[model samples]
Target: MSIRHGLLALLDQGPHYGYQLRTEFEERTGATWPLNVGQVYTTLGRLERDGLVAPAGEDGEGHVFYAITDAGRAELRDWFGTPVRRDSPPRDELAIKLAMAVTVPGVDVREVVQAQRRHSMRALQDYTRLKARALAADLSAAGPDPDGPDPDGPDRDLAWLLVLDQLIFQTEAEVRWLDHCETRLARHRPAPAAPQAPATAPQASAPAAPQAPARRRGSGSARR
Candidate 1:
């Protein structure tokens, strides 16, 4: 996640202390990434060094505040304008595991797929439940105009709803992908060959006189 750009975007609005930045970030992103206070300060330092942000004095409580610079504004504009690049996606551990499971010997790829599907389904359910609660709360708070849009209102709840929806969709997608992997594995896996025992044919043989090896010459002479 681009925490740097995220901080810059937040700073674009106004100057804020580290804790404030972290709080606002979580509020907007629904704490999905959960920015740490130390991390916020660290990011602020980098942004200051990079001329994207600057120390804008301190608040009444002596908390140092940061404000976005012209450079940061330009970067934020570009970030909003540019489409997210999908050529390189974040590495998915489950996908890697399934990929190896299907290709490696002694691996039960079907079991792997089922296990991951269960985990993803559970996560999807959790997110769905969270969404339901959020929707219910939003409706309760809105009263009669529950479905009406809020033109000039705080959107923390809405932000959380969007985040939860994204997680739900992502988890659902993973479950579907696991099913796809199982189906594709079945098609790709070769059939196990039947085990064969050693073939031994019984045969009748005629008895024959066996010739013994000649004794050593020295031993025969001694005996004679």
Candidate 2:
């Protein structure tokens, strides 16, 4: 998510100082993505320059509060209308590590794969636990919707639950892909060569005793 847009969204809620915006953003995201105070101020500066936000005023502490402009609200609406682009996928560091491991000598690729699978499985478990917590929070915060007879209004835990769900899905996919890779590797392995039977020894031929009989027959006849 763009920090600029995030800050604008927070400003859309209410006027907020830089520090307040940073804290609120982290609270909303459950700190899965922490924002630096410096980044918050920098993004605010850019937003002010773009005319998307403006200085509302300063507090007694000399901290300037910012509020979203009409332009910012329009941008936020447009952002909500458009789906995030997925033309290019972000690089997966684990995938790159495994790719290099298989090509490089002395690297145990299967060991690497197993290690990653273990890590991903642990992450999946963590996300699953967090999801349960989010669901419980949602139930606890449930109230009648103001606009309708629906038993549940918007849950405050929705943002964290969405982030947790994404983590859970991604980790599960990694584990399954690792298992598939192991199966493919095993299938592609070369088969062992079959052992040959011992060779048989050739039998020796009989001596040519018949050849001498021809010469002896001639001599014997002459003698006769």
Candidate 3:
């Protein structure tokens, strides 16, 4: 999602001010990633600097309008013509957590995994509920016969539903992975060992009784 390319594509459609571009971009993207006015201006500035776009004129409110140039059109065409690679960098948070968990001692990894499973399940439930509600509302507003087609229907709703479906699938997959993690952790945990008592040293054998004291003591007592 290059901001420069996106702004150029919008400008290619027609000349527009920064604010107008921002509004249109959000609308077209279903407001999934809200664009700031500053970002729009920044992207426009870059596009102007690159000679992909140029200032058209000022509007009634003194906002400068920008129009795509010949070079911009060529760039847009190249962008559209190019195929995006499906091999994107992976961002697996659970993998990182599991890697670190094994390194930490006394970390009760099972508990950590179970907690994540609970959280993921809750998220899946919430997303499912939201999707159901959205679909119901879309049907209700669809008019008389539920199956009747909408003559003036907008495809934006369908696009939103598709996005929601993707999110739901991702969340469900995460929940299933969490369950597997918990099961594996429980299955692999080692059982606790029983404690042992300390060993006592054997008592030394008693030495032979000392010989009786010499009779000299008795003789000295008699002389005294």
lDDT by residue for model 1 over 60-103, one digit each (tens)? 88999889999999999999999989999999888788778767
Question: What would the TM-scores of all predictions be?
Answer: 0.77, 0.75, 0.62
Best by lDDT: 1
Evaluated at residue 130, the lDDT of candidate 2 is 85
lDDT of 2 at 110: 78
Off by over 4 Å in 1: 144-153, 190-224
Query: Taking the tens digit of each residue's C-alpha lDDT, what string does model 3 give over 1-224?
Result: 67788888889879999999998777656576789999999888888899999999997889999999999999999998998766894668887898799789988787777788788788778778867886886887676866777653445467667767877898888878878877776678764677878888998999999998777645646553
RMSD of 2: 11.1
Residue 127, model 2: lDDT of: 84
Clashing pairs in 1: none
Candidate 1 lDDT: 0.84
The collision pairs in model 3 are none
lDDT of 2 by residue, 1-224 (tens): 68888888788888999999999889878898998999999899999999999999999999999999999999999987888889977787988997888789988777788888888888888889889988986885675555664332343377778888888887888889999988876687533478898898898897866544345445546543
Candidate number with greatest TM-score: 1
Clashes (candidate 2): 0
Clashes per candidate, residues 3 or more apart or on different chains: 0, 0, 0
Model 2 ranges off by over 4 Å: 143-154, 189-224
Q: After superposition, how far is residue 178 of candidate 2 from its true place, in Å?
A: 1.6
lDDT of 2: 0.83
The regions of model 3 sitting more than 4 angstroms off are 28-30, 70-83, 86-90, 140-153, 187-224
